[model samples]
Target: MKILLYFEGQNIIGKSGIGRALSHQKRALASMGIDYTLDPKATDYDLLHINTYGPKSLQMVKRAKKLGKKVVFHAHSTEEDFRNSFIGSNQLAPLVKKWLVALYQEADHLITPTPYSKKLLRSYGLTQPISAISNGIDLKKYYPDEKKEAAFRKYFHLSETQKVVICVGLFFERKGILDFVEIAKKMPEYTFIWFGDVPMLSIPAAVRRVVKKDHPKNVIFPGYINGDLIEGAYSGADLFFFPSYEETEGIVVLEALASQQQVLLRDIPVYDGWLNDRMNCYMGNDNQEFEQLIRQLVEHQLPNLSMAGFKTAQEKSITQIGAELKAVYQEVLERPYDHQIYAKVTK
Candidate 1:
């Protein structure tokens, strides 16, 4: 079947989950042995998968609907991001919400990365078929051996004996940067690393200077990092702490799992079916729980890990996840998706 994948924005090459999701979609399409094109005007395709409902994406979605084409929104984030970043906090949010509701009402299917996200969207009165197709992992890029602990230590001028923790995302409140700051203060023994861009958002010069000035010796904020470096960071790190309050699903957690690094996330319900305490993840509520979990992880007294459990979790390999996505596209195109899908292959 022919399909058109629409991205509302330009490439976010090496930063966030949208890039990861886009990569998965492309890989899934290729795995299906399907002839897919991007931004094609005159193509015969089975479906058109719009990535978002932004201004650009909305136009594409409307046109696809006009052509009587089946469509899916690989909606990986909350409508809040679009309402805030794309439309600003002005009258635009309400306007966009109306348009999105209309677009969603007209959509043949809505694809969500997490069940929690689906439940949340349902609260928004989006009464449509919602499928839980994750923005899955590429195990080849992430593995237990890929984390270069020694290299990371040397590059960051950190001691091999020192503990390392990583938090990947921009300096957004929803990403829980301040929560990380509090965690950094409590854990002076471990070297905390923030591997994401700060310049993307508008921060006051005074706040920037203050963040730099108050940065503890244990904390380091390296700007944007590429894949090799990111793999190395994940490989060498002892833990991944992402306390996001408003993420659809943090794909970074999957990357961390692939590296066999223990995950510590805020107690977000959508993470329930995926993360297991001490097994694939550690869930936290307040700073105390976060601190306690970190201490336990350091002590190695929680979800006991064997090579077997680690391997099983990491088995959500690139080919495996990509195949599932391809099947979702096929199923959505053929008819409305009602059955659960966690074990589908590309073929």
Candidate 2:
């Protein structure tokens, strides 16, 4: 069946996790030869697959339901992940949750990136069906590349002998940016790089303080980047250290794994089932633990789990994502359309 793969306000979401996830879904659909349209106004599609929680998406949901169309709402942003994200975000979190719950409750089906998120959404008292799907990775684009690695080092002016640790995310407190900076300070011998940025006005004052004035000399904030440089960062870096406090599912983790980079992640619920400590990757509970783990990795005390991480990335390949999405679409189409699902909002 044809689908309308829609993402509202994409211009505002540039290179963010939600935007990246939407791109992955498009590639997945293409690989499966599924007919789809990005146009929300397209009249030929059988289903509406919305990837954002904006006002436009909420309106589309209402309009689609009125037309007796199936709506698959992707639950990319939960209130928990929204807190500490921007200036005044924590204070606005309750309102965000209310809106999110109201919007998601109207969906015929909901898709989230992990079971942890599915559980979290259920806790919001949502009775709609929810499926956990990976924001799959493109292995071909992110695999090990020596030439790109060399270029990344040359461009950054990093010496070959210096141990490099990298994290990729927007300058959000929830992404553990403060912890990242602190950890970098603890390990002065290693060069720490954070490859993301947000407008200073939008960032919280606390995060802005650390990013602008308090960060140590060993830390480098290169702002946002992509293409060969980023791909090379994943491949060439000695460690992919992500201290994010929350995630529905981190797409960067998948990219790092696909690139065969050794990953170090904060022990968060989102990675509860798949990622194990010291198995496919390393895990740390806090900044101190993260520092200890980094030291162990540097000393060769920890074994190379890059190959194991690569195997995990393989499981979430675009082809697999496509097949799963197609199955979900088929299931959605075959199920009897219940007009009553629209009753809550219509009233």
Best by lDDT: 2
lDDT of 2 by residue, 66-133 (tens): 77789999999999999999888989999999999988988889999999999999999999789999
lDDT of 2 at 217: 92
Weakest lDDT window of 10 consecutive positions for candidate 1? 338-347
What CA RMSD would you report for each candidate? Answer: 5.9, 1.2
Stretches off by above 4 angstroms in model 2 are 343-347
Which lDDT value does model 2 have at 309?
A: 95
Question: How do all models score by TM-score?
Answer: 0.84, 0.97
Tell me model 1's lDDT, rounded to 2 decimals.
Answer: 0.70
For model 1, what is the alpha-carbon lDDT of residue 150?
60
| Residue-by-residue lDDT tens digits, candidate 1, 289-331 | 8888888876677763434335644656657666766777777
lDDT of model 1, residue 209: 47
